[model samples]
Target: MQTLPPMLNLNDLRFFVMAVTHGGFAAAGRALGVPKSTVSKRVAELEQALQARLLYRSSRSFTLTDAGRDFYEHARASLIEAEAAQEAVQRRVAEPSGTVRITASVPTAQQYLAVHLPALARAYPRLHVQLEVSDRMVDLVQEGFDIAVRSHFAPLPDSGLVQRPLAVEAIVLVAAPSYLAARGVPAAPGHLTGHDGLLTGVAAGTWRLSGPDGARMEVAPVPRMTVNESVVLLGAAMAGLGIVPLPQELCRAAVASGQLVRVLPDWTAGSVTTTLLMPARRGQLPGVRATVDFLVNCLQPAEPAGSAGQ
Candidate 1:
């Protein structure tokens, strides 16, 4: 039968190393911010555990035995390694100097994350950001993503991840000015049927709209083009292909630039809440935390901007 190695107390070893290095119990106690008696007791306990006499003590002086010298050398080496390990971890925590892998929807990545990343990089010079843009729901832990930005109409499904609200995104009908000029703007939800529709996969062919007075209407226009990605639908709308519903944040610049104009101004095509999510474990990491804070600050400003139309 194999025998297990003896267990050693690291704290006791540390005390012994400190006592020897400081040349006396009182000095070691002062250095460690403890009572001298506590230092002496810890050293005694270490010696007892080792089953060897490690020090020679007199009222006037202190000395180390040959055995104590050998033990001290090894103990001091262990302390050095422990301190180095601690400092290595602390340095990473102090500086956000690592790759942060993020997964987000195509529109969020293109409109919000991709455009804003340069600012984050400038703020955290040592941080490397990796973005994965997709519309599929990502398994954060399984896919090794540090964070994710997700959009939802209802509450997010229970995925056991920590979620922080990023923005409440209002979906609005948008069309290229040329398209609206050619097809004429819709007076209300009922009139949208006369206009060509560029539909996203999530919306299928149906649009659910809410008016200013809490009245809801659902319209299903024949799609001239269908896309699974919001960014693609936004592009199709900007190309004067058809009217499409998009998050206001994604189309805000276009609206301001006269590339696209809001249709049915009194009615909105419902809203979806955007959230930042991460595995509970990754949420505590310094790099992940910094990225989350940066995104939160960026997205919060868009909320008021989105509501300015109302």
Candidate 2:
């Protein structure tokens, strides 16, 4: 029969090492933030467990026996190794270096992450990412994704997932200058009845618009074409096919380049909030957390210039 080695109390080993290094139990207890009596009792228990006397204490001095000296050297080495092990684990937890799996809608992946992720890779050279772009509402846990970028018009339900709002993008009606000039700009929600509409998503035909004075209305525009893809709808609008309501971020570059113009400047087709979602458990990992913060910083709309210090 083989015998198992004795299992030692880690606290006892720690106390023993500290006692020797500090020259006495009292000093060791002070360094360890414990009562000397507690330290002494723990050390005594350690000696009893090991069946050996580790220290020789007299009225004049405290010294180590031959066995104690040998034990001390081994104990000191063990403690050093133990501390190094703990620090290694802690450093892994602190540093962001690992693969992070993410999911985002096609438009979001293109308009935001596609442009920003290269910078993230440059900044954290050791961090790797796997991005899955789809319009499906992915089950983050079941699908094994670390993070998800989602956009919705309403507050997400209580799904027990952690969600961080990245930005609120205004849904604006846009069209090419040629299209607007030919079809004539819709002066009000009612004026959209005759104009051709290029729409996307589930609520393709209907548009919910809020006017300048906080008045809200809904309009069902005449659909020239309806598709679930925003990029395609944007293309159709840019080709002067019709008007389309899209998130401002999607059309920002086109608007800047004069390829598209906002159809209703004083009215908006509601707003969609871009959110960062992650499984509650995965949020604790260093790499996942770092990626979340980085994406949030990159995607969130910047504050208007000169708005600070007010």
Candidate 3:
């Protein structure tokens, strides 16, 4: 008789979920409250039983392979439903316990995530967040990241990963009063040629705007004093370098303090977005769903008037 390999036990399922989730063994063990070696051993056993390479590993980190992703897509939902069913009948209400791997940039973390997130952590003590901050794009499924965020002006790739609109971010042209006094404010978009330009070479050119009448108006590009990455665009604008298009969150305090002036209030560029991208498999899991929902709620645009960008 052709002997079958050992059945995938519940312990294997738990570890498999953990490894793919945390993006590495160390995080998985931390969440599972077990030794790191234990997590590694169980996943290795699970891989052996399944007769497939579940993850691609290296000394620094590990990520899921294609077959692992497929298996995860199917198994995660099953596990969540099974766990939820058991929890419904059990006296001990189990709080959501799992790992959520995230890819973000320093700007997003400092400006938005700092104040908006963390409520989720307090709500689910067992939930673990592994954040990788970089300005570059990330492969959601390959890296095993539960959620990835970016404020990109470029077109997103046609990956099968699940994506949701986190927020419709708008960039407003702002200048400090000191700058306006020194260089004088341009009355119209074309007059920007006379002003000192703070260019964030990240996306060069004149900022585009949609006016009250829904007409497309093109503002002339400003010749920059300093050309570099857009990461510090807000700081340059605050130092009165020149008028720059900044996310509302970045210029709020300056606007409130009357240190900076919002130019062309009727204009905003819809080209930018604060989006949430996640692996389709992880999106199916209960803890992943809960975290995304919570973030969406936090990113909600205020009704009419909202808080300033800090």
lDDT of 1 at 27: 95
Q: What is candidate 3's local distance difference test score?
A: 0.74
Error of 2 at 194 (Å): 1.3
Which model, 1 or 3, shows the larger lDDT?
A: 1
Candidate 1: tens digits of C-alpha lDDT, residues 123-172: 99889999998888889999999999987667788889998888887888
Q: What is the lDDT of residue 45 in candidate 3?
A: 90
**CA lDDT of 193 in candidate 1?**
77
The C-alpha stretches of model 2 lying farther than 4 A from their native spots are: 1-93, 201-203, 301-310
Best by TM-score: 2
RMSD (Cα, Å) of model 3: 19.5
Output the lDDT of residue 12, model 3: 83
Clash statistics: count for each candidate: 0, 0, 1
Candidates, ranked, lDDT: 2, 1, 3
Q: Which ten residues in a row have the lowest lDDT in candidate 3?
A: 301-310
| TM-score of each model, paired residue for residue | 0.66, 0.69, 0.64
